[model samples]
Target chain A: MIITPIDSTAPPEPTPTPTRTPTPPASSASVRRSRLGRTLEPFGFIAPTALLMLVLMIVPIVLVIGYSFTDNVILNKNPEFVGIENFVTVLTDGVFATAIGNTLVFTVVSVIAHLLIGLAFAMLLNSPLVSNASRAVFRVIYILPWLFTAAVIAVLWRMLLSPNGVVNYLLSSDLEWLSSPALALGAVTFINIWAGYPFFMVSLLAGLQGIPADLYEAATVDGANGVQRFFNVTLPQLRPIIISMTLLDLIWTSQQFALIWLTTGGGPINVTEMLSTFTYKLAFSRYEFALASTSAVLILLFSMVLAFFYVRHQRARD
Target chain B: MSKEAHGRRRTLRVLGASAAAVALFATAGCSASSDSGSGDGGDVTLEFAQWWEPELPDGAFRELMDEFEAENPGIKVELLSGPYASTKEQLFAGAAAGTMSDVVGLDGAWVSDFANQGAIADLTALMAESDYDDSELASQIQVDGATYMIPVVNFVYPMFTNDDLLAQAGVAAPPADRSEFAAAANAVAGLGDNTSGWILPLSLEAPNGIQNDVMSWVWATGGSMLDGGQPDVTNDEVTSAVEYIKGLWDEGAIAPGAFTMKEQDKVEEFTNGRVGMMIDSLAHINLIRETNPDLKFSISALPAEDGFDGERGIPYASWGIGVAESSEHPAEAWKLVDFLMSEETNAKLSSIANAFPGNTESVPDFVAEDELFATAFEIYQNGYPANEFTGLPVAEQLMRLFDEQFQVLLDGGQSVDEMLQKTQEAWLAEF
Candidate 1:
């Protein structure tokens, strides 16, 4: 996992061979020793993450993929292979389509909203007008979103957003916002943004803080205005974190089920049915495990394609 | 630090970390066995599963379980109740996949569904050996010409009326028929300020007290939730039932949150003097009285049509106990079921649970001797059995459709004829 951090970035920094060459004039044995140390250094750093990735991630994916092809009844009898049938059924179903559409809208809007707002907060937090103590306070405030468990976050949001809840209590309207198809997607997105933006804000703040003060200083010294300094230096410095966070958000928000499940249960007319909740309802609620498994495989395929594009784009950026 | 050595160290680190993680996960799977106490027969464990997580407050079931343990001496029964919504899903999965417990609770109505799936064991022979009359078990056990589930207790749905509230409206009896019930609702509703005539659950949601309250009315009018021998819901009888409900709505007998209130809310409102009356499961006698012991209420058959042959009310489906197919000790499991369901034990259990124990002896004693359950038992006897499949896969959808149309019909904004046509069309097409 850590080795990938150094992979294919900046074309080897356009090496000037002689100037950057290892100085080995002290002795051939010393040169050999340095070479050997260099060889082990990457592994020394990456071994832990690589090991975690294999056990915690790879093994499960392999198991699920193997199960996907089988009619694993899961309780009574041994599972046997049915092969691609689950996938085919899921793709053909209209409900899965609705779920996918809802998930896409939720993921895209929530991720972008969190990213832009987080960046804005990051910039404001970086301001000179805000004192260090208050900035620390704001940092603490930002953790509120991250601290709420998903179920609690959903319930809190539901009460605040219900027709009879505080949202309408403040607004003074009996509008069934959750049951309204026009507003349901936005309502869920609002929850995801509220519950998830703190992560982005915190990560962006850290990334922005890591930017060299000298570069901003240099730009300002060169008579670059505030906007120019931000565009030229701050933006470039935060690009890597922003792209990664967006990808992470895509994966996380797209899979939101608990919030929607608790709040609406895919409501008034299946208006808020996202893939994750739909799959759960199918597998458990209706006991359509085969169809549920098929939907899962479809989600896996869609996300893999998304991840592939993200990685390729990331590679291109590097 | 050569290339080979570097690779070897990385692999070793990965392997070491993986080994630790695997060990940690493997350790988490261990569970403490419940059957750990001293046993005269050296500890026999019976894993019992039910949808109820906590035992009902009624103490009868526990007493029965203790008696079973005493009778058998060494066998211990462990209770398992899962989360409400998906426990059945889990049970279905467990049954289909063949790892179910020693005994399970099956809804008497869905005996056929489970039986068809081969997920439940046939208990025909077991019933024959028991003291229970085999013919009476017909409603629960003989679905699709076969015996599948065994009844543990039977709960009948009855019309629960607030006697004081009824007197305030100058009425003698709650309601004897469809016409009188609607008239009574209007009159009694006049007693309380801004009060509606009834507090039936309008929502299809859980604890949807108002809706089920209304269903008794619908069924009493000779409508079935399902068409004859088919799941297709759209039909004239259903439409007539919907129309009758619309008429009640027109009379302004419904509560404001009736369409949306949780089930318990209906019962609670009536008990708290918030509503004139509520209709619900007769098993609620204990729980209802718990809220307000002084509150005056009576159980009666829901108002029937002018001259219907059958009793007007519905007997909410029965419950059954069955041994699992996988049990190594089927005899012990059946013995336990039979004992718990025996006349004496069932009577004791029924008293504690505040429900109709399946045993005829137990039921007669409770209904005939006990004051509390007498009215409810009479209602159960005269009432038609609520079908096992009344609420099926699309139950919520059916309830919502009924509420929506019922509301429209009452508001006089839509004709009952039109409402029924559209609603039934949508209903029948669903299945």
Candidate 2:
């Protein structure tokens, strides 16, 4: 028997022995129908979700946009289109300007603080110096604030920060944390940060664990100090997660209405007024639904800009 | 196609069709469930949406509805109850969608807006059509000469003073005038251990604080926030009241968190003996009594200015009721309204709610039994029930706008003149 070695890259020679009848190609109409079925198949699977989104989200958005151009809709039996009048009114209003400024400060500060605190906690939890049992305990404790709903968080913080509440008793100072024009905005923001940081912490914790040990070891071998290793290796490794979480937090925090509403109610004197509260007051409190719609549309556009960046970042990462 | 590919495609198509059917059925099911009481039946079921059921004593409102159902053989009433805020939101949403309940619990403040939008039926027309006697009704909220709402029960705002605190400060009685109120407030503050003279809740969230507390001062002096149904917030009486309140704020006589405090907080402060006084609703009398049984308190007419000598204006809020314009059974809804407004039912409801009856011919029995109610009744008889915000367009918004400026005034961020001026402008814009 002759042992032959086949060239691996070469095409195999075809061996022919048996004969078979040829199958005829189908008619053009059947082929077209099959192609159409393939195309329509995925849509069928998603039809329910698509229908729900249309009814719940897209329809409301379109209606609100339409309303922004009208005069006192919902309350008016026959609202006439005013075309940008509501937009002008909302833009020129001083309260809307104040709401915009406050929303920006609240969003920017919350996102930055959430990132820093979340990263710090994630790193601490990820540390090998800690026991697994201790980490698990701390993780639950850290995540406790996030477990509460907005209403619960608002009520809890209100009780805790009242003039004669435990916070005051502990500090031995009678500060009106949720009432003072100077303090209310900062107070609500702190509560939001507390309630929100756990999301980032959990996400970054998983990201931290996923980073290979070799990068840190390499940095350590290359004369990198702990801080240097963190800046050079850990932070860079966590950058994508940081960006994604930051954008998400920005979106969530900017739209925070329930906490502010349940707490200071955007007052002493509009000190804590966010765009969400401003729009709500116009529609519900003031019954100026058209004006509210205008404000809402503006907020939607702003959110879409943030969402654009988020989507772009996500795509690039993918 | 291969047999496997053909099978896969068939499976996908079946799954898609099933999903579409499920979605369609879900939507249809929701629509059917939402139209529950509107179904065709031998008996008509009227959906009554209200916050009043929760406010009434447990099973009291339900008993009243049972009585109505018993009296009318072919009619049934279904309650949709919630807190005031949630109820208001639901009613507004329903109104916008033209799906409001057959009968609605309305705030007097909401009548003008609801009527303007044609969301509520014109009671004047309903009354005429049914030949319902409107003479016995105490008052009707009207817009454009058409009645849109009628008060079912009235809750007057009276001055509530913590007797123990007043005694501790050597104050002999509840203040009868603004000057006395100021002096007594200061005295109470001077004897303080974190205790303030008064709790003035001016929260913009629910700025009835302005209507019930701040404006009650002006109203108590027979001053009106309106002149011929127009904004008159910068009038002398309103200015004087604002000045008086500002004086208290400057002297630290008002509660610490007045800007953010709500009606509930005001009641809480008075109940806990943390504050000496508050202008509070009669609706809260039972609540205060229940929350702090040992807290001694007295009710009085909101104090007038030093030298004013006219019949005082007593600020009052009402549990106003209306029929939805979109109600299919408008006649049946009117019957329920008429039943609720009857002399016997009105008296019974007022007694249960600790409020005054809306029927001119009826008096709540509690007025005879409860001393506080007797005092309130005498006060009500002597003074006119005044609330200019009621029946005004965007009344709550007016209160909130005034609240914002008044808050600024209290914080010393603006003068009383500026506050009134700005508030006047805001009010005029709404008008």
Candidate 3:
């Protein structure tokens, strides 16, 4: 009994157990997962915008593609699946070829003029000769055409270019601008360039402001004159913005519906029929939705190719 | 400031922002919800889609709606009006979505197309209950032995003459024949560079505009736009008419901008005394009189070719009302259509719209107030209904086919024979 009491009062001897290191906070893999989650946190904030793009943009494109393969007349309740019949019809159609040609001509000519005028104004505004106040005023004035709606601009130009209208009056020439088969497309293209260049002006002006002044100074010190400096320093620096804007302008001008529709409506013998107006006429006028959808898909493909160049440039920059 | 006070301020800001968002959402939700409900308190609501031009005097339609609502206490109506194009677009969009208005106003030419597509309901039974079921105008809306719509109002395309211009040019008013027309046109055209002798709506804005303006010429030559439901654009009559128009173009008798001027632009030109003679619908008489009180003008049947008698063919276009196939309130919709076709309502509407009533017996009294309406009414008797593509499911396409070829010919890009042949071939390929 005395021995049991001694044992009960005494502390137990420590066992020879290997000591475990304090858990190394968390595993490296877990740390990487956490880091990934943190990186994805920003994506979470943009998910709603991404979802909208998917629904609004991507879904419509998919639907259009699906419709392109069907005999989807507006009057028909049920669209029959016709495989590549619609595409075949569209491709074989002569009107589509003419429309493509018009669209190309319109885009090329308008974009070139847009860039030249936009860059000219942008350089002028970016010059040291321009006071801040004067620059602000000129900016607003130059942007005025852009602020106007396409319909209003088209109507205004239609009035101006009319045979008995102010433009002929000013020029003292009885030139029939919009009604002439030779001049209708050119006149509309001119109006488009007028209305659309201001966008490029504003965008290029901002881009010009971002270039380092020292680079231009150095360019001047290297014996480069105004034109030389522009071609070597300014243009090279503005290359990204120019490329991006060119792509955007190409897409917009190719899909220019309102201006052409309001002005010529693919008229004067369809010499001004762009793909956009042609598709619209097909759908709304002819109720040939399947053919219109095929045309629309072709336009989308063309635009996407241009968009691809833009996206590739952007990703490369990143 | 204390941290606690800052926290309190932040909390208040968040709460205010939340309240603002909720209120915004509530307002948006209310507006979205109200789009579906009756404006006035009623058990059932029906949407009546109409192309009531707001810019024009439309008080008669409003009065008709008021009368209808008074008589039908349980049902309320909401008007959906806009330009013809916009209204048609809305109706079509609604039809596709199964949310179309119970009653829709459609161009008469499109009735058969809509009926064939089953976009509109067959009103045969409802029309049978009405006295106008067997009327000539009602017959225009029938397809495949079923009356799909009730014609409401119509317009006849006629020539308007500026009396002062005629006197100034020493040309007689109401050119008796095509020779006189050409002479008057030449005289007026020779007056000044700004003044045109004649104005034709060569613009391809719509088939109705260009076709009505020029097809009457063809018809006057005993030509037809359609030969047994097929386009005969190359027929001798059409070729002769085309040659005449081209001659007018070459002679500089037509307005400088006539090739591209819309119907409205033509009206503007005529009202402003810039044109001596203009081909337009009779509906513009009131508008012209209002715009130019001192501008004396006369309306007459379009002139015939020189050798032909002064007798002419007038093109008439119309609009009608129909029930949507998907209408939930078709019975109530029929009531609106019935009321619209009633003699009293028809008279009132035709007067305000400056149109001839679909119910021939209900011609408005004011129609006799002016020689223009009188002439138009007389011509309406001989009008060919101008439903050139009736029963053609590809009606709009046929119109477009004609429009394109007509545009080419107007632009002086091709010969009449070539253009017509091309159009004929195209029509054949499509049909």
Candidate 4:
């Protein structure tokens, strides 16, 4: 009933908290007030985050989940609860199916490419012989995309890829980079991976450094090659991080719409509509709030599964 | 030891506060946003939310705003221009979240949608009570037979011709008949390397332009898009009009990259003296003229061939101002609307802004010398809006269908027969 995400895989903690932590003892009159303060200090320190999370994150999510059960059109003064109807409608809806298909395809493509390329780059950055200045320069260039606003990145990439835009000017011909349906989805996914890989690369580098060098040294002494060393020792060490990153990336990429929306507006026959874009179009453009919330809650439900896996993975690592 | 530790903590706290204060001060004194809140009585600031481009947050309109503030004792306007594509997105979010401004600017097409949703006000009674004239308003203000919008400036379609090309081609004047127009394309086909002979955008992506053009053809053939206030796209005239446009697509008379061209690209093709003929919005008249005032481009109506009256007129578009029904100050908003429609205010706005006058009484004088205005007025006088086919919000998918399928048909990706059937199917599904 407590619904800990890691009900089975959490194994067991070695011990619970020890009860006898030391407290500063004070004298007579002031002692009572200070003792009370001592008892409440931890609560006071935790209060801000607790309040923020409750109001900002928890309340909105609860409202969304609640709205998913109701009919909440634009002009409706009060929403009517119709239990399970929105969910049933979503399951039967063709548009929802198309969006989920598109979203999953985009997520898998972007995540796999990101992990492979990010791992390679992370290893390169972690090389002991790489110069500090060169490393700094590469880090700056890599992190730049993450620093840029998604809107700016979308717009910049749009300009680069427009038919008669800068890219065509450089090539001295109308390359038809964006207009053609053949290259359109690939173009968008490439931009996504380029804009996304640096975060994974930096994190992977940190994870790589945490893997003891002595393990790799032992593998090398056993006459394992460089690629073999990576697969045997490095792969085993990074499994938890990789799983967590995959789950995180899946959620993030599935929810990504601004880049696609700004770049293509889900055109060339709604080719770019992922789950998030479909929900946004329904909620805002179509004013079908009940339907949009249904889509959102569906995403939430899937995210809950990912969240459970993530928590279990993290706890196991602990 | 405890006192010293407390002293050290106090010093750290002061340092943190100092750093925070410095950061806050750094951002302060940058620009006092006029729309943050209603200042004291001496300075009333109003926030305006719109998606107009030239009227971007800090462009030509910014200087005008500074001037408005300079003259009015305490009245300041903060302009919030959102992205053009996402205005509808912002408007609906405004409806749901209750974040709309006191004044709203939207396409006249949307007045009814917003009015029905209880998001916009009933300007009918407001106008009746005031000195507002209904004739000055745009033609599309009525939604479900209710008058509910304030007509701002309009951007009606008027055909533009390269007079120099027509003269050289021995066409005495721009064609006034559709048969003659088609013949004109044949004659002008190989005029020169620099000449494309004729140009109309294939995209219809900006459907208003295409709607205007198609309606001209429909009217030319004595047909309307609606009969008894319903869509009638299957009619003989509508069918012929579609085929006639398809014929032009077949003739290869349009610019090659017309499908991919944006608004500016279309204008540049015409303005660079490449296109022999072009059709565009009346609002873009200044833009065309500004490119090269010396260019002998002229404005005219779309030629007619099959009208019962032996001629037809362009279909029109209009822009308008509307107050949110949720506005806190409806009375004040109405006052602003009345002021905007007043002859004095109209003249002031028209002189400063490139906006056409909305007052019917004064528009004649305004357009007396300007031939472009004369042509647009002629179009507006005779123009009609095609049936919306679907409701405005729902019509997005329908319009997208028209745009997308037109591209498909133009590219020969589908036969005309298939295009017709598919278009009907798409519209029926959306409608």
* Model 1 deviation from native, Cα RMSD in Å: 8.7
Q: Best DockQ goes to which candidate?
A: 2
| Inter-residue clash pairs, candidate 3 | none
The CAPRI classification for model 3 reads as incorrect
- How many clashing pairs in candidate 3? 0
TM-score of every candidate: 0.73, 0.94, 0.86, 0.75
What candidate 4 gets wrong by more than 4 Å, as runs, is A1-41, A121-148, A156-175, A205-218, A233-241, B1-94, B97-100, B131-133, B138-140, B159-224, B244-279, B285-300, B303-317, B327-329, B364-397, B404-431
Query: Candidate 2, clashing residue pairs?
Result: none
Sort every candidate by DockQ, greatest first. 2, 3, 1, 4
Give the DockQ (C-alpha) for candidate 4. Answer: 0.10
Global Cα lDDT for candidate 1: 0.67
B119 Cα displacement, candidate 2 (Å): 1.5
Per-residue lDDT tens digits for candidate 2, residues B181-242, read 99999999998688999888877787889888888888899888888889988899889888
The alpha-carbon deviation from the true structure for residue B243 of candidate 2, after best TM-score superposition, in angstroms, is 0.7
**Which candidate leads in TM-score?**
2
For candidate 3, the per-residue lDDT at B151 reads 64
The DockQ assigned to candidate 3 is: 0.18
What is the C-alpha lDDT profile of model 4 across B290-319, one tens digit per residue? 887877877776765544454354544444
Better of 3 and 4 by DockQ: 3
Q: After superposition, how far is residue A5 of candidate 4 from its true place, in Å?
A: 46
**Could you report the Cα RMSD, in angstroms, for every candidate shown?**
8.7, 3.9, 8.7, 8.7
Weakest ten-residue segment in model 3 chain B by summed lDDT = B131-140
